[model samples]
Target: MSMTVARRPHRLLTMAPAVLALGALFVIPAAPAVQKGDDFLTPETTGVLNLEPGECFTDPEYSPAAGEDIVLYTTCDQHADNQSYGFVHADDGPYDRVALADFGWTSCKRGFVNYWPGAAGAELDYYPILPTAETWADGDRDIMCVVYDPRGELGGSMLPRAS
Candidate 1:
C-alpha cells in the first residue's frame, strides 16, 4: 500500500484582506460616533504641559490670565472634548496682540487644514488662542490651535489616518 501526505493550504493570502478590512471596520466606528459633552474642559494634569502631536485635550474655560494653560487630556476614542492640532510661535522681539491674532488666525487655519483634511468639506471648525497683550508682554508667544465640531463634541482625533 502507498500512502500520500497532504499539505495545508496557505491561509495568509486568503485571510490578509479580511484581516485588514476587519481592522478598518473596528477603527472606523471610533471616529464618527463620539458623544459630545457639556463639560468641555478637562481637569489639569501634567500631560497638558507636555502636549504632543495627535494628543486630545480640553480647556473650555481657558484663560491666559490664569497663567499657563491647564489642559485636561482625554482619549480620542469617542469622548474627546477638544483636540490640539498644532502650535505657532511669534518671531523674536515684540509683536502687537492684534498682529499676533492675525498671524494666529492664518497660521492655525493652515495648521487645521493640514492636520485635518475634513475641515475642507465643512466637517470641522478651528480656533486659535493667541497670547493676550498681558501675556505677550510677559514673553508668551505660543499660539495654540484647536480643532472642534461646532455642531457637537467628538470622540476621536480629527487627524487623517495613514493609508
Candidate 2:
C-alpha cells in the first residue's frame, strides 16, 4: 500500500494577521533609558553617573575636592558579594576609576525606574584607581557609580530632581 500524504493548504487570511501581530509584538521598541544629560542610568553600564530605572547608575567623581564629600543619591541594599553591592567607576580616561570610600547602606536598593526612587543620600566611600586592587576592589574612582538592587531594576536610576 502506498502512503499518500495530504498537503496542508496555505491560509493567508488566518495566518497573515497572526504573523503580523507576533511581529509587531516582538518588534516593539523600548525607549533607551540612558542618554546624554538624560536622567536615566543603567546598572549594567558603570561609567554613567546618573541613575534611571531600568538602567544602570553611577555617581560623579570627588576630585580636586577630594576628601570633600560629593552629595550622592544611591540605592540601598546589602548583596552577598561586596563587588555586587558597592559603587564602581564607569571607565578610564580622566575618570579612570574609583568608588566611594566611607561606605554605608540605606534600606532600598530597588528604586523606581520611571518611578525615580529617592536617593538614600550617603557620603561616597571612595578609593583611588590602582592596578593592584583589580581582583579585590571594584576599580578606580569614576565619576560614574551605580545603584544596585535586585528587587526591581537591580540598580537604581537617578531622580529627575537629582539633575
C-alpha RMSD of each candidate structure in angstroms: 12.9, 15.4
- The alpha-carbon lDDT assigned to residue 140 of candidate 1 equals 71
| Local lDDT at 135 for model 1 | 59
- lDDT comparing candidate 2 with the true structure: 0.31
Among all candidates shown, the one with the greatest lDDT: 1
TM-score of structure candidate 2 = 0.20
Error of 1 at 74 (Å): 0.9
> In model 1, which runs have C-alpha deviations exceeding 4 angstroms?
1-50, 59-71, 118-121
lDDT of 1 by residue, 93-131 (tens): 775756766887788888877776656437677766666
